[model samples]
Target: MLGAIVGDIIGSAYEFNNTKRKEFHLFTPKSKFTDDTVMTLAVARWLCGDKEHRKETLVRHMQELGRRYPTAGYGGSFMRWLHNPEPQPYNSYGNGSAMRVSPVAFYAHSLQEALGLAKISAEVTHNHPEGIKGAQAIASSIYLARHGATKREIKSYAEEQFHYDLSPQLDDIRPTYSYDMSCQNTVPQALLAFLEGANFEDVIRIAVSLGGDSDTIAAMAGSIAQAFYGIPQNLASYCYALLTPYLRTILNKFEESIGVLTPDPFDIERFIKAQNDDNTYQQALKEILQGHKTSHWIWYIFPQLKGLGHSTYSQYYGLADTDEARTFLANPCLNERLREITNALLIYKDRNIERLMGSSIDALKLKSSMTLFDAISPNDIFSKVLDVFYDGKKDRNTLQIISKTFNGHISNN
Candidate 1:
């Protein structure tokens, strides 16, 4: 999915200025994300929210995101379709259907599901058989690649199912290939690029070297290449930095919804149980806590606290005046962790636990927000600290005693 966006941005500058050779700068000042990137994200957003796969839901989100970027190089007919008060399929067979359909491959649980969702995504505007077929072919190929299917298996499936000529070599087709918008002309060529490339970068080069519809072609090829080779961190980061905040948020939400962004519970538990020595435990806990502040692991261990909530659990040693907690809370990392924890708890649906976690995080945020210049209320601080750090056995008298202890500690510090 990230590879498709990267390919679109890299190839955007070269779309009009055709190049038959693969040798060129991968990115330039003129490079930008195009309609391919926009529609890909739109599809992802729709999939994230629409678990039921409703056609109306897909249409609404697609149009909403599409309208947000009206000048992102959408074709004339498609642009009109986006703006129409009541849009309908134009029976078009443009490769737009395939370019935006990559996310379906990752979102679907099975090949059949991928094909079905791809068809639904395309038919909103591209009701043409070729357009729908193009989407299904790309999505199915990606589905196979993701599930560890060999190139031979993918080639055989694509050829037999969609009747695309998968036998053409890139060398054979490169010399005469020209700009093409038809799915039949474009989709097979894009697949051939993926079949022939050595890596993700090579796939993009092969698609662009064909000298036709560079961005969309590379986008389709890169979509498959991503599933096969996986995207490089530097390239993925660069492409992500180019996206607007809204798009980035949607992308993160989609990834988390699919469990790609969330840490595996088994892995977390394994790490926790693997510790032996105090130093090893402290270091491991720090690393895990640092990596996933919003993780349920924090809550899993929260009720068994000994000292400062974040520091005591993360580090074996504790600091006075809750300096470590204050420092972490002031940084963006803590805020992100808070959001992640809050979201997880909300999804977990345990009202009592959610309320405790939410209130603790909110109090910590508020405490961090207060400045030294502001009048500090002991009661408020005491209540918040007690709420967060209290173990099961602490009564109000014990809590108040601990609070006074904290108050004295703060005054002295």
Candidate 2:
């Protein structure tokens, strides 16, 4: 998966320049992740979200991520499909389907499973027969490479199954190949590059030297190369450094969820420290108060502190003691809603915690257990104003004044 992202970034600069030689620097200042990396990460995220690998899940996640990154160099038709209120396959035969199917290889346990998942991954956008075939071929090659199949065996199987012409050498293909996006044209060349390369880097270089759709081809080849050669530590680190923190976090979570290796507790501590150092908590709180959506950093980080003893919570919040921390944690209404909001955010349900908080308050109106004022302790108007403010239905200044006054009352009580 990292290999595919690295390859995309490496080839991004040359995608338009059409370099036919492998002598170009692997990483340049202009290098960036494109649609290929985005969709690949989306697939990994979707897979991590559930135990079942359903087509609807793939479609939903892909569209969600796609909408998040509108200028990710997606094909025009595909972009339209992504934004459609009711998204359906547009019958694309483009290589976008194959470039993003790399994660299918890692998630499947058997060749049959890989092929089935590959089909499901592609048919959501690229349901054309050639598109489906291209994805299957790339995924099967990756599956075989990971399971220790030799290059000759992989080539033989791809040829027999997908009828891709893999006989041409890189030397022969480099001179004449031009930019092409069709799955039939690109997948075989990318596979050939993988089949002939000595290592992961060699595979990317060979794929780029073909000089057509450089990033997508290299991304396809890199996926196979990663399975066979395993990415070097230095290269993997370099690639990871190029990703945004959000993408890196998803990659880490996806890898962890898929049994790539349990994260070291020390590494997790380091991650927490990094988040704290970045003032992630302060930013999340500000966003909540200002009626903006906060990142999932809060959802992930708060849970670690939540279930710990009140002493730990006090330490986390710089409170004076366990009793002081309990002012917030001991409030059943607030605590229950916080848990629900955290779960919802983890699954990408509601982006705004403030909105979710307000919804929880509204739901209280229909419940017999308690009203918001009763839950928050006998401040009826204060509770209603808090709900309205958090829901973005009232003035910010009024909300702040009320919030401060309410906080003072709670503290005195």
Candidate 3:
């Protein structure tokens, strides 16, 4: 599903200025996600949240997101449909149907379901048989590809089911192909691009090189390519950073709902277990655990949620890099939590542990803001009281005031 967005962004720069060769840059300063991505997310959100798959619900999400990103290169008909008080299908056969229909492939459980959902998604605006067929053909091809179907099987299925001529090779189609908006003209060429490519990026390059409706063609091909080869981690991360927070949230939620999770780069659970098994660490943990469970300590150390057996934080929070570590260190809850852990372990004076504590304390103090302190009070006022002990700079009166504040916060919690 995200491959569609990646392709859209990569091809956006070359859409109007067609490039008939595959060696061009994948992204330039002008590259950005287009209508293909916005509508793809809308369909994915619909599949994630709307169990009944009602057209009214689908229409609401599409219109709502479409209006939110009004200048995403929407066609005249779709733009009108977005503004309409009561829009109806325009019986159009634009490649928009296929461009936005990739989500259906990921959301559906079977090829039959993929075809059915693709039809429902398309008929909201593209009620034309060709439009709906174009969507179904793309969705079904993706479904087949992801479910271990060979390229031959996918080509045969698309040809037999949608009657698209999959016989033309890219070399035959590329030179003469020009700008085309019709699904029939675009869908088969896009599939041919996918059929010829060796990997996900290669498919997108092939589609873009066809010299017509570059973004949409690449989106359709990338959808299938992703299902077949999976997206490269670096490319996926790059594309993910381009989305707005709202769009990123929806994309993450939809992927989570579909069990398409980020791969864990490290064995965090094993690390935790190893730490737990160390007698020195375990003894220190027991003293400072303060009636709190190890789970609480775990949460403080690794703030990201668990997924598919590992921490998703490393992926979503950008925490795997040293540069990004500073961002997490600035997190108030994490800061306070780490402070509590380090403070508790302070008495042990284990050289390695104390060194880590010293560095963490330094970083926290450097990044600390009054807002972080203020935020920590409600969630963990106890940490505030301990700070006086750690600093040894608070006067007796300040200690008294902090103790009172801590007692009050404990009661509130």
Query: What shift in Å separates residue 120 of candidate 2 from its native position after superposition?
Result: 0.3
Candidate 2, 1-413: lDDT as tens digits: 77788788788878988888878877654567888988999988887886688888888888887776666788889888888888898899999989999988998889999999899889999999999999999999999999999999999999999998888887987898999999999999999999889899999998988898999999999999999998866456556544544566678888887688623311223334534667765565454454444354432233222112234322232211222223434545445544343333334223443363345422222121112222344453323433433342333332232343342221110
Expressed as tens digits, the lDDT of each residue in 1-413 for candidate 3 is 99899888888889999999999987654677888999999999999999999999999999998887787889887899999999999999999999999998998998889999999999999999999999999999999998999999999998898898988778987889999999999999989999999999999999999998999999999999999999876567656655655677688899999998774222223334433555534543564544322322332343321111133322333222221233445545445545656556444433332233345432233122212333334334334433433442223332332343332121110
Tell me the whole-model lDDT of each prediction, alpha carbons only: 0.69, 0.69, 0.72
- Flag clash pairs in model 2: none
Per-residue error at 220 for model 2, in Å?
0.5
Give per-model TM-scores: 0.65, 0.64, 0.67
Give candidate 3's error at residue 133 in angstroms: 0.4
The residue-level lDDT of candidate 1 at 159 comes to: 97
Q: Go through the candidates in order and give the C-alpha RMSD of each one to the true structure.
A: 15.1, 15.2, 11.0
Q: Name the regions of candidate 1 deviating beyond 4 angstroms.
A: 262-413
Candidate 2 ranges with C-alpha deviation above 4 Å? 262-413
lDDT string for model 1 (35-147, tens) is 99889998998898888988788888878987877768889999988888888999999999999999999999999999999999999999999999999999999999999
Candidate 1, position 294, lDDT = 32
Error of 1 at 43 (Å): 0.9
lDDT value, candidate 3, whole model = 0.72
